[model samples]
Target: MSERIYSDYLNEYCKDSSIFLVKESEGRVKNFLNLDQEIPDQYRWRFSDLNSIVKQVRSENTRQGLNKIYWTDQSRNIEAYIIMTWWRGNELVRSCLNGLNRREVIVPAIAARSLLELSTVFLLNANTLEKNFKKIMFPPETIVISTDIENLVAKMIWGTRYQPKDELLTQTNIMTALKKLAKSPGTKDLMPTYDFLCDIAHPSFIGNTSYWSHIEVINPDGSERRLMSRLTDRQYNTEITDKTLWALAWSSTCIYNAFIIMRDAYSGLLKKI
Candidate 1:
């Protein structure tokens, strides 16, 4: 597995429809942003705690070494990719939290979506390494599992860290990654939230029309009803803002957990090796 393209991965691992699960998820995405409900009191506390934890966890970036790593060049390369991946995820969590504080909707949702994607992929790779530490660390030239797994990890890191600004692209099929994330152990509950964030991140109905615009019922002649759409200048409706806050908080928490899990797993595996 020499880091094949998205289509090649799809062709080998997927069935006839590459976008089937993604399409299914799209229909399941809801317009909950328009719900007329107050923010939960517990969510307010959770949001504050999330902010504090994010600030604290962000301070751990300077600790880069594996303390007592003993591995070959290949393992070291993987370690470096994992470290950079963690940094990228941390940056996204901060960006999403900042957007939430500013009451920004679309951009924060976008950032949260990216954060979720990164966290999911990192968890995937980390879990794989944990289960097959010796196999992955001491990979042979022709082992299908090791190469494919390595390339998958590399694809995510490369897409985020190496792509040029002018021709930016992601190597992973986002929906595929998300589906895998949802099905993976300890992450099944995140599917709905991830789908909702996807709805907000894209320029679809809930993402744009319901999020950035409101409807007005105008009765000009008192005999007929006409509906009008008005832009909000990026201002969030009260309920929408609350929902976005929850989303950002939830995504930030997920990323933070991923970072801790990754760091510990990397260190633990290095010591074992």
Candidate 2:
């Protein structure tokens, strides 16, 4: 096949501002078996199902007949879910940034936790794509295995949030899937960073990453703690503060890495077509 250029698709679909691209996004994520909860306006661009995504994006809204450009059958569900997870995570990160830019008062704990979750979702997407790509391209036993991995990854990704179980995917959890993701040239920082990300997401003592204070108390051993300080009213506003910037940096980098990996994987498949 001739070279397939997917740059435009990547650019339009992979960014954070994409949350603004929809009038509204709603549906029950059947993959997770979660109730069809309505999506709030802030999450207007998120979708967890591949079947619903095509109709909403092209046939339903744009009238652009682009459904065939994406996977359409049960056989390709894994590929579709991988893209959906990454894109959804991308938009989520972007939405948080947009809210920050607007100076909306946000709970840092919530923001930090959300960023941590998005990072994990992206990592999971990468793992899913790597594990199933060959299975996706072949036949018979490959298809069966690919389908199972795809569905399992799908359920694992959403199940983390929805808490429902799919009997088929329950054999192995998402943590296992994450561990199976192939190492990437640039993904070395993923897991180590994720360690700290968890703290920010959970309610651990160190996880309450907001309102820090620092007093350089040299102990009897002459050890000094990190130079941390609480944000004062006189400091550059919360959104621009060092802590907030670090959160944004972590979120954007995680999202971008996921996007690049997802984008490359899809582009490779497109070339095979």
* Candidate of highest lDDT: 1
For residues 212-236, could you state the per-residue lDDT of candidate 1 as single tens digits? 4433455666554433334334333
Clashing pairs in 1: none
TM-score of each: 0.53, 0.45
Give the least accurate 10-residue stretch of model 1, judged by summed lDDT. 27-36
List candidate 2 stretches off by more than 4 Å: 1-87, 95-106, 134-145, 156-163, 170-244, 270-273
139-220 per-residue lDDT for model 2 (tens digits): 3222222355446555644454344565553434434543444264644544544444455556664444343445457788
- Could you tell me which 10 consecutive residues in candidate 2 have the lowest summed lDDT? 23-32
lDDT of 1: 0.49
